[model samples]
Target: MKESSVASTNMAFTDCMTPTELPAEKNGMRMKNWRNRIGLFLKPNLSKHTKNRSHRPSSDDLNQWAQSFDKLLSHKYGKAFFLIFSKSEFCEENIEFWTACEDLKTITSHAKLASKANSMYEEFIRDEAPKEINLDFHTKNAITQSLHDLSASSFLAAQLKVYSLMENNSYPRFIHSDLYRGLCVTSTAEEP
Candidate 1:
């Protein structure tokens, strides 16, 4: 056989053999094989950038809305209801303001509180804001004063007002609407 044919046959045979049997000094092939084996076990199975959706409320949570306003707002279905209800002109800002306040409260870093507070005021409180919420002058002034001190509760009063508005106004309309009624039917059907 030609020299090339003999080399090809040897290459094919070696490729079929296990890495452990290969020489440690052969281009550090043994280390490469061990590293790959270890890497698989060391690497995490989960994606770093994926958001956790486990916070979504169960069907039981939806059924308990009549028990308390707090229960309703905390549930994921409450967010869904608000999103649909906000489709009316001038109504979307209420939900937006409440959501911004919710997000603001999650920030634990002291340095971030001031900046987030300022942005929230600009977007939801200041006159002629792009998405100005229905804040009375008293609530707006309180928020403006709180911005100087900058805490998680800086938007509390305004948030509470909007939350009350939603609870008393949009929420009743939502409960009486077809969308909410459909969700109720679907949730009941899903229960075993």
Candidate 2:
């Protein structure tokens, strides 16, 4: 399609999303401050930005409306409803804010959980990667670095996915169990 046609189509689609008609299908998300709050959040935004930014408010109304919609959906549908977005969308819009009920400290704590997972992946690859090899040192390091990146990315993908390792009783659970057991054993042995 032509650029102008695409832009117009986008505008029309956006116009159809009315906050007043939100809270449909008992999705559990509510629009607590459907109008005012969204207005503030999308205050400085323009309509065009929304399509490009992904979950971003193109206008003030969209933000306030989404916040309200989310609240209603959570109340009715529960936590499972919020998993509609992919990880990129969740992170972009800061999904944890409302999911954890706006607790900044808890949000930070969850972030640490994700960060710790990433560090674990990196550390595993680093330790396993060969130090001395037939290739040049730099080349070996580069290959190891790629391996590290792949491991870390996989971990993140698993965590962010709603039905993935986040709740799986397999690899992640085993790793955590092993880690805690190791810590406990180390502390006991060091005691006088």
Candidate 3:
């Protein structure tokens, strides 16, 4: 049997929407602002979640998704972005195909919208803080730990079971909490 690939039949659904053209300086500023906003909202919660070290979960999948999200937003909202939904209207028909596209579409769109909003806010509202302050090393390390913790919380054979569960909607939520929110919020905050 051949390994299954997550490819969407609907090309439109998989495309990402890019933002309007902007000078390099302004574009960098916009991303910084968005990163700040997200960072502020998630830092408090994600920080606590990262302290437990007994767990040692791998972040390969999460990292891949994050990279894909960044690539989409870099377009400046010109192309269509998507997130593959694990369970959706087409779940019964295309199962893997439809779901992957939906989740990717949703995630990419969100990241792009967030970037745009931050860009507009920085231009009109106020300048954001420096980019270096919002590091998520702590959070990422913690989540990696928690993934390992879950297995202890469950049986050995069921080890990879919870891992699969992590792939659903919660993955996005987790990413936002651990990565985007923290990075975005910190960069957007102004220096006192």
TM-score of predicted model 3?
0.20
Q: Write the per-residue lDDT of candidate 2 for residues 1-192, one digit (tens) a residue.
A: 996676556434332222223346422243332223233323333443343443331233222323454332334222322322212111212233223222222333545545553443343224452211112345335534544334223323222332232233222222233222332343343333
Model 2, 111: alpha-carbon shift in Å? 15
Model 2 deviation from native, Cα RMSD in Å: 23.0
Task: Give the 10-residue window scoring lowest on summed lDDT in candidate 2.
Answer: 85-94
Which 10-residue window in model 1 sums to the lowest lDDT? 13-22
TM-score-best of 1 and 3? 1
Give lDDT tens digits, candidate 1, residues 1-192: 996676557534321222223355652554344335334322333544534424333457666765566777777667755554454312677787888899999999888878888888888789999888777788889888888888898899888888887777667666665445555554554444
Pairs with backbone N, CA or C atoms under 3 Å apart (clashes), candidate 1: none
lDDT of 3 by residue, 95-120 (tens): 22222223333443545544533432
TM-score to true structure, per model: 0.64, 0.18, 0.20
Where model 3 places Cα greater than 4 Å from the true spot, the runs are: 1-21, 40-58, 64-192
Segments in model 1 whose C-alpha atoms lie over 4 Å from true places: 1-59, 88-90
**Clash number for model 1?**
0
RMSD of each: 23.7, 23.0, 21.0
Q: State the lDDT at 135 in candidate 2.
A: 26
Cα-based lDDT at residue 149, candidate 1: 84
